[model samples]
Target: MSFKYMPVLRSRENEKRAFKNFFDNKIFSSNTIIPLIEIIQYSPNRKNTTDSKLPEEIFEESYVNEFKNYDFPIIVDIPMYIDLNSNIKQKYKDFLSEMLSNSNKKTPSKRLIYFNKLSKLKNIIPVVSYNPNAPYPLKTISTQEKYLRTNFNKIAFRVFVNINTITHILNEVEQSITSEDILILDLQDDDYKETKFNTLFQKIEDIKTSKKCKTIILNTPITEDIIKKNKNVQNDCPINAIDNSIVFSYKSFGFDAFGDYAGIKKYLGPDNNGNNYNPPVTYNIFYAYHQNKYIKFKSQTINASKPVVAPSITKSKCWNMYGHTHHKNCPGCIEINNKSIDTSKPGNWGTWQAINIQHYIYTMNDFL
Candidate 1:
């Protein structure tokens, strides 16, 4: 919830470990080369609200120095990260290529990028990681369905649904109604009321009856109040119950199955006999949510990177991508709870650029 400064262990070693963990795990990637755009708000001039005297320059300098080694085509989320008054936009605003072009020194295209969904900026690609549970844009889901059927047969699909994202799920089902792939809908969280739950179940029942194979995964993230009533539905399968109040567990997997760090592991929960659950690490956060705070603070004084699609995870094989939080030039990270990180204070966030590439490249070479 709050932020703090922490330490960075041997920087290279820690980053290497993070990269290894990210790629080793099983994360879904659609077949398109959609880049993951992670963004964070970077404010260097504003000294620590806690300590105004601390020169912000030193902190930012250190931040950039730490990550400068990661040289790659970084798509900076420009709008949110840079000074609006700055002329980087005007000086190089002649064309789209100029916006991204880095060759001309006088008007070097700063990697800091920015755009709104409807903004008419060409060559500024939009990217998303797939979210199977939520309703999705028809076009996106249609594209995903085509890719899935082409590559693999009998794919084990999972979806983590909630009220907000349910629309996307409906869109996906509508798109997939004629497709050959089976869909396993994992309806997560406990906040929904009975009427809504039944309504959702009915919708699924209809889809299943008409569509290909389908299964329902139900979990109550706080109290298992709803699970008790709905466990017996013909299509519903109770997997696990969790306390949504626990920030770590909620972030780990509760948000969306496979969307968070410990998705499959937490969703499985304990065996029939209640006991300590120790799930294996199928994937780890190469960069944790709060880790981005440090990444941003440690980044250079240069303009912030504009947010773009996550290039690492979204590839030719990926259909759609999803994650929490967004900004024009977001440094894809956040702080939840008061845990102290080791790099800056426990409070700083680490924004990323090219780190996703570390895992993405590895995934393409090793897995695909």
Candidate 2:
């Protein structure tokens, strides 16, 4: 696959619609991508310890029937979506045993039964989500997780280590998860943008050297410096996948899944059946409305009531928008100035976002 972009499905409703879309072939015509989801407890007080807060509704008959519609591997994340809000008398494994067992039957000793049932599904590669809580170090949790994974057949299970935990408890993490498991990292922090690329590259290099997992950067906005062309290290790392949740983000912005826009609707393929362009449409020259480009996101940022302008939409500010744009900023200050984006293009916000996703995929391919 060409740098998989696994979109995260965070809720029951969100997941339901996404799965329906997948079954109907409304999105992801390409096999290179799949919907990713994290199992989480919706309620702060999860009274039902026996029931899983994750994989919330997928096991129901309706969802099982729906899965027969498509034949693509889903990158299922099994990381700890949030800390356990309530205390339990038994370990998580005990809870797992009860979850997969029949309503009247008890199988507290055979936890692998859960994995066996899940593994039967030919389309999902479940990287069981994990989080170690307050009292234990990551090493302990990692060891327990590995034990759980071993109960199932090798092909059925993988591990997803949360970035926050991995960064701190690497040794214990190393003990628990392997290079084969997926490590989830996100550069959503703006503070990270200020650091040298070499620093980040070195960190990635070290992680790759140690964990050696199929790595992923998730739910991050496309930034110029992160994907700037001509940077060799960007493509040299072991990072295997990425997900741009701009569509979901747009929905959060109160739009109805960006379906409101006609220009973008055409690209949201239904029957195209994975025709993500032959040879993978490398975004070189002629990418963004012909010629290289720069994009500066306008902001409504301020400190208190004193409005501060986003450096992006300014006269002198500059950013590396996938390519260098040493363009002098001025009024009508873009177009020619931005070596990547042409202001002359006719598109609304939705159209621009769709084009931007293309830009992201092509640019990230350089890293893969």
Candidate 3:
């Protein structure tokens, strides 16, 4: 199946919610978008007693299987922080084998293995990072190469680099990659700059000139800093629009697709101690995507004393006007329109995240 957008989503509950809701409702064709699911490291439990789960355990519990019923390819990726040591490496391989074997069992061989549990699943694309700064760069490259040569028909080899290292990384991996594979150029949370975009455009031209890979995806994130800065503006509940011209600009250069963190921030740091504490007071920040710009809607702070109240954004005239003008009638929009669906409580943040992501995917499909 062909894909137009590559949304870099984490393997977490909120993302799962978004995927399931989007696909189950038949909102759009699954083939329209390919989700790059990053298997985030497990955090400590609420009690904070035990250590976090190893890479293998996290893989086993990943939400990848939730999309088993979908027709499109799903790219599963391990974050860079998880070192590819021998033990964890073997576990990852075994986990993949088990998932493939298990998938074949539940469904007929002719049908695409949606976690069939008995045969190999052809649509699960594995990601192999080629970052030089990562531990054991040679080993990482070798592991990625092994995946490319072995089980999977296609591999998404990713590199997170800036202008300084783009040429080096591209040259370094040129020999190992093939025309069939996907190359991910991850520009995580970098503020947009003309010079940087031009340099990247040239680098991509070089890759195309060399015929390094046929499918190259460019991914960036809408950072919290951007959201905060916009919210601080003088306008009341201002609609913060994120510029996406950089993504569209590359389309003319024959780039396969564009991607982002699905409105989620890109976290590259180590796992924090598992402390899931809800603040006594918080604002309801909602997100939407329209006309290639990510829209952020912030509400006044909601105190814990009145957890049941709807956020001010929902009650404001601005939201009402925007809803009528720009809303896509997605599940998120429906929820927002229904003032009874309170997203004020801190625990309900996932609901909002899922809403934003669902709408974002819906809008992106229309544009793509």
Candidate 2 worst ten-residue window by lDDT: 257-266
Per-residue alpha-carbon lDDT of candidate 1 for residues 86-171, written as tens digits (9 for 90 to 100): 34323212222323344223332222122222122222222212333323434543443344334333332334456567656565
Off by over 4 Å in 1: 1-138, 156-168, 177-180, 218-368
Candidate 3 weakest ten by summed lDDT: 109-118
Candidate 2 RMSD to the correct structure:
15.8
Off by over 4 Å in 2: 26-31, 41-69, 83-116, 132-136, 151-168, 175-180, 186-191, 194-201, 209-212, 220-368
| Alpha-carbon shift of residue 327 in model 2 (angstroms) | 32
Which portions of model 3 show Cα errors greater than 4 Å? 42-58, 61-67, 81-119, 131-139, 196-199, 209-217, 228-231, 234-242, 267-273, 284-296, 300-329, 339-347
Report lDDT (CA) for all predictions. Answer: 0.29, 0.36, 0.54
Using lDDT as the yardstick, the better of models 2 and 3 is: 3
Q: What is the lDDT of candidate 1?
A: 0.29
TM-score of each: 0.26, 0.42, 0.71
Please give, for residues 47-151, the per-residue lDDT of candidate 2 as tens digits.
454665454343333343444566765544334322333332223323333442331223222223333444556665555433343332334444335545654
